[model samples]
Target: MVAYHSSALDGVAANPALPTPLLLRLIAFDGGGHGPPFQALHRPGLPEPAVAAVLTHPVLNARVQFAMSGQADAEQRARLANDSSPRVRAAVAYGPEWTHDHRTKVRPLPDAVCARLLEDPEPSVRSALLDSRHLAPSFLASLVRHPDPAARHAALRVWDELTPDGRTALLDDADPEVRRSAALCACPHDARLTAALLRDSAALPEALSHGLLRRADAERFLAEGVHLVELAGNPSLPADLVDRLAVHPDDSVRLAVSLRPELTEARRAAIDFTVAPHAQEHVGWVAAGIADQGVLRRAATSTHPLLRRAAARSPHLPPDLLRHLAADTDVVVRTNLAVHHPDTPEEVLMSVYARLGGTFSAWMATGHPHFPREGLAARFADHPDGIYRQLAVRDPAAGPDLIERLSHDPDVWTRQAATRDPRLPLPRLLEALALPELASSAGANPALPAGEMAVVMDEAGVPA
Candidate 1:
């Protein structure tokens, strides 16, 4: 599978007719006063012409230059390291595609470039560097004592890599926040430190809740009558204390107790818990450990709805389980299966889209590979709801006239979808490029010929 993040301009970039020279021109198109420069420069393995154009195109603006820096070669990065623009330099510091978590195996910057960025005058550049996984161990150790408390906390992402002295420094740091972060990093391994963190009022709630609290410490927290809400959710809390909190006077405490993973449905029913319909918190069982197929199957068939919801999030579920959950009575179960499960049936995705048409999850559902698009024009061309009408453009059955007419649809989503559909005639497509609202989708429509795209670039004032 091609491991690339989808971009709005991907169809334009992927056009076979878009020659090297024209793609290079995209690096300097200046967006025709519409939006950011064409994102083709951010794709991997740019031909030498595109690389040279980015390096030597003095007229290229800062934002386009920043896009090139994401995929720059070591030599290109070395040049960008000294570029006058802080944003460009910041991009160099962060390595390739740092903003997106797609690429994991990134080559580190040259040692000199790393040294320069560490002391770079711009805080944004240094901040971007902290987020990059390409930073060397030595740089990470130095950042542990950085003047900025946030940097000190961020550096703890690689706590095991830090020197023993560096770890001790964070644990004993004067800043309570830094110490609290260190406690989170160290508590799982060090019981003594975990016990100490449980005493500090500032750290008590998080430490008691997240750390594996000792049995005695769990009892102590219960006896104190403080942080009961936090204690109720702690996995390490003694069974007796968990029972005691299930009936605690505080509603929040019982609510937390009711959601604990160890509690069976019968036990949870005994608690006076009022579930907020929209915001019921389920255990993130997938994150906790979801590899065992047996455990996943049990979760899928569990009597508790939350367990079924968690099971639906497992991407590796067998087709039988997916079918079972897709037909599950719970809306969240069906939606989660559609959004997260790779083999979710086409019918389930359309159902979720119908229920959550304008939501983020609905966007994800429509983007799924198996989403139904082939005959949608016949089904939704004149649906009363504009969201349903937008599906018409996705259907091959949608005629050029239908697409052009929908391009003028009052609903923005329908209009945008029509603008991207290749069936929309070229003249109307070019006209859509002038509308700031639709330029991005129009610019990406694959039907726009390579010659016309070059003309669009030239009109946008690309350098010769």
Candidate 2:
């Protein structure tokens, strides 16, 4: 036997290749015999050629793989469809390069591959395929059947691309997201589909249901009409709704309707059932819109003060009615007529003033531009009532002579009113203030007698 001494070989070697025996021994040291093959293909400074050689090398090719998911270049991508490693095959399945047309190239991944990936112990890979825009429809359908809510949501997003029948099938989907998407994505123009959606109360979101019910164009559905009925049934329905129902033919239904602008004449006439003061007041107003002067005149005598007042204020009230209301026992009704009655005679107004003293006369005097100021002033001067005298003095229409005469009037309010007269001259103001009796009274009561003092002081060059 030849003795191969390692120390002798190291000394003798000078760029000599490894001996055949040594080479075999080194190759066998690697379990798979792949070490020498890989080293040969991965030599430094020759990257492209080395990689190509490794991909094709008989011994190393079993460990190498490429992604062939899909691409416009079908044949090139399909060449790696049978790649050994699952990672490389999954890369092919989700490769960005695989556009819609490239999907056909991936024809049939093995059942094992599909099932394993579908249940992919890894969620990320499964999710990518589930959400892929270019995913095959058949594959997506299969995925939707998986017991995953996320997969169903993803499938629903693309339901519109499916055939009409396919979309209809999703309406019964176990997942609400899928069902809702089906309802919303159904062709709005298709009345059948819209009706179907409307019928499935379970599948609708509250907002979407409301939107459909309120849709102006879908009037044929009578959805709004139904809602209006529901609103009528609501015990908390607005008073306006009851007012609307007041005229409804179905007395029962009418009770549900509130006050709306669309109330019919007959319906409005039916509101007479309401005897409450406020209800009567509103009815009187509504009646004024429809009733003649005769009817309003009758209402003006209504026991309810508000009804009487409304009748009195009616612009369409006849002259005869106004004359009747001018003598109303209710001061408010009388006052209303005094201020608003266009045809009320001057005599009737003056009579109202004389009978109903206080601010009633003042209100009439202020509002009626044609009120007889001289008559009122004379009445004030002669009348035993101090309030009448005060009202006459404050009349803007009162002449200066009447005011001057009233300036010396015995009543303090009468004199105060006279001083307030914008027409009262400076000399008269000073004279009224300087009188011993008037000056003493003016000093005693600051507010009542202060008016003449203000005028007199202002005329005397005193800062007002």
Candidate 3:
């Protein structure tokens, strides 16, 4: 079988004039956005005929069209805007589901689709319409007044897009959440509104910070124990108020101070200093923050492996402790040192690997932070122990060539492991399945083509 496109939408280009059976297979393929195969497709270009086939695909599955809407020209987007499946229309309204911050274009939806999806029955789909550029000021004005307060909460996401009038409508909303969200966007609120919002327990910190409430009001709320943690987080607090909270009885509140110079000895010994139940990760952080050599050394030698693992990762862990931890009996502690302890000497890392020669940790320490080079990955790939070789095969640094070699590993179990690696793209997966011993496991691999998975059994002459 030909390899499926990484993104299901690209399958339309497989044959712009696909037969019904093939078209059905393409449409039935996973969305490839987040599920099995875990791949995303990118087309060199979309030919018009292929898109027409995607729209006309007899099956009602519209997810392919949904994925393609992002790349469609204005006219094609308009046609997709009217697609019968609400799912397709929702996609048109939503535009591209993913965009990085540096990307210049915040993909805008068509006005028609944007207006409709604002009231889309699907809550999540409706929330997405908040990002569409085509949702103009006029539409947002009406949306802000919609009876549903939920619409107001959703509107806050795109608050930067709203017109002055639209912004005003939300600022004056009866709903405290709308007002709270508006304040979150840094909109100034009047005293009357602030007073009302301050009384709302749910609206505590946001409303108080922007509310311009009197110091008396703030002190009253603080005395009442309203939003102590939140008050601690408010960056805009008056300096006098900040000094008062710095010594507040709550240790957690004291921890919240971003510029807190140091912890008092009594505070350091508090129960909050270390998390309980075998993950003293917090203790590691506190000790590192203080750069206390005594604390780190004690934690490193502690009988508890979790504390040792935590201490191993500390920047202040001295070279002597790093050496001590490299040879630790606990597998987690030893691996933690290999993967995370930068201060450990190269000689120490090498010795750790020699002790646990077959492990990923052993292979990993050769270059330290840099992935194992070809020579090291190959050494593990060619290791006598199938498990270590399997680990090497699974490592991202081990490229396709290593995978091809392991696919024919004499042990059926090793070949089976080779078949299911999520990184083993579909073409490599199919090639691995050619080894009949891999057949049973290949069918179970999430990477197998959903519609054509039967091919694994068919070619291997094994039953599903």
Candidate 4:
């Protein structure tokens, strides 16, 4: 038999003596001669039997009852605060909720209440007291050395509000993580402490970009290959260093340097043929290119090779101007006009292609989104380059013969691209699934029979 508190039935002389088991059953027993115990306990102005049952035998939790009961007022809260169970005391401490009118007038907890909890034997109760935003700064400063690291960590959040004397105490403390946390929020600008903090790997990234490390230290880390990828990605990385890394052997390193916020980064990522565009030159070019009545006037008169190239690459430059640029004395300017200007008219491109047929510029123009697909079928249908045939297979104009021809193209790329063709029938799709290399791509084609797809995946041990 389970024992229950007799306090549940106090102050009821009229209540009949009931068996302990029967009363225990009544606690959870909502159905009774007095209807449900729940309705009787909570509903006001109840009949005597229901009230008697509720007052005598309650199965409902005390916290829920306390939370719901209006009678748990200031006096009741104080009474519960002294209860032997720490749980009851903690619940009581959550209370005496301030009224809207008194919220601004009230502190988070009364000084006396805070004082009591500050000394609570239970860590949970004491930890709850740490949530007070309005706690005295001196109090938090003192807790910084609290025996419990959890409490100390909580106190660290208010480190900024602590007296400078208090902050000085923890800044050089033995714990590195605590020191790192301080460095992040403080931005103390102390070169020595910053260097020490950076020694901790956890703090290295922030330290590298804190913009306080000497240029030598930053460059030293860069040279030693320490955190190169992350260091390259740092926005605060010196421009000179970024320029140096643009040609690094590692593709990811160069890619990182290329993604910087401005045109410097763009130019870094570009094929910097022989001579590269300078930052100032790019700025001047953008200015003149966006200016009205000036690109023609400027390019005709300007002497800077990079500036001339930048002007040639502008989309707003007229077809007549693009044609003129195509014949420029500077080969680089002509190349930029041919390959980089997306808005250059098609007539200009065809003319450029005819003159510069074998150059990289012409090859790039051939695939430009605006390049007319007028003869893509004849030009690329059986082109030696697999990429070209892959493009041909995907072209909407590809006829059945070309699609079938590409389905067996020596290049797997062309074969994969053919799987998307609506004209490729179910038999060809089944053949595609039989090839392990093409099975995944072929499985995605709706034309493949569902049963065949299942069989192929099962044989291949593939999940649906």
Best by TM-score: 1
As a TM-score, model 1 comes out at 0.76
TM agreement with the true structure for every prediction? 0.76, 0.31, 0.51, 0.33
On TM-score, who's better, 1 or 4?
A: 1
Which runs of model 1 end up more than 4 angstroms from their true locations? 1-17, 29-46, 55-84, 94-123, 132-155, 158-180, 189-191, 214-216, 280-286, 290-299, 408-410, 427-440
Off by over 4 Å in 4: 1-84, 87-115, 127-142, 145-149, 174-180, 183-188, 209-211, 224-239, 242-464
Q: Candidate 1 vs candidate 3: which has greater lDDT? A: 1
Give per-residue lDDT, candidate 3, residue 334. 64
Q: Which lDDT tens digits does candidate 4 get at residues 1-464? A: 11221111210111132223333333334222222222112322334343344433333344333322333333433444444556555644554333212212223334465557667888666665665344545556566776655556555777768777656656654576665676654544666666776677778776665435556776888779766755665545667887777777776566455444343323743723233432223333255345454554455334545556667766567666666666667766755665767665565565565556656666666655565656666777777877666657646677877777788889886787786565676677667655766655565564555455335323432222
Top candidate (lDDT): 1
Superposition error at 410 for model 4 (Å): 56
Model 2 regions lying over 4 Å from their true place: 1-280, 284-306, 351-361, 391-402, 410-412, 422-425, 430-464
Task: Give per-residue CA lDDT, model 2, range 1-464, as digits (tens).
Answer: 11221211121111022233332322222223323222221122223333333334344332222232232222332334345544544554454443222113444443344455566556655665555454555556554555786776665666656666666667667887776666666533444554455556654332222232323323332334443433333333345444554555553344334222244445544554333322323442335253565557556545445556668766577766676777676666665666665566666566666666555444553456445555565556666766677667645577778777777777776776675465565667555445544443232222323343333323332222
Alpha-carbon local distance difference test for all models? 0.73, 0.47, 0.55, 0.53
The weakest ten consecutive residues by lDDT in model 4 span 5-14
> Compared with the true structure, what per-residue lDDT tens digits does model 1 show for residues 1-464?
11222233444554445677778756544453332243565555668777666655554353334433455565655666766777777877776654222212456776667767867899988888777767666666667787878678877887988889989999888888888889888886667877988778777777777777788888876888988888898877779889899889998899788767776768876888765545435565444556568767767776666667888887878878888898897888888877777788998999899999999778878888789989899899889899999998889888999999999998998998999888899999989877877876787787887776766655545544
User: How well does candidate 4 score on lDDT at residue 223?
Assistant: 79
Q: Candidate 2 or 4, higher lDDT?
A: 4
**After superposition, which runs of candidate 3 have C-alpha atoms over 4 Å from their true positions?**
1-48, 62-79, 91-112, 119-153, 160-164, 174-180, 183-193, 208-213, 259-376, 382-404, 408-431, 434-464
Write candidate 3's Cα lDDT for 1-464 as tens digits. Answer: 22322222222223223334433343344332221121112222345554565565444444434344444554465566556676666666666544321122444545565666666777666665675554555555557677778767667766767778877888878997787777656423355556666666777566664455556766776788867765654544566776677677786665454322233334333323222333433342434343578776766766545557666666566778877887787665665666665556655565566666655666556547433334546567777877556556646677666666776787665676666555556776665544445644554455556454434223322222
In model 2, the Cα lDDT at residue 308 comes to 67
Q: Better model by TM-score, 3 or 4?
A: 3
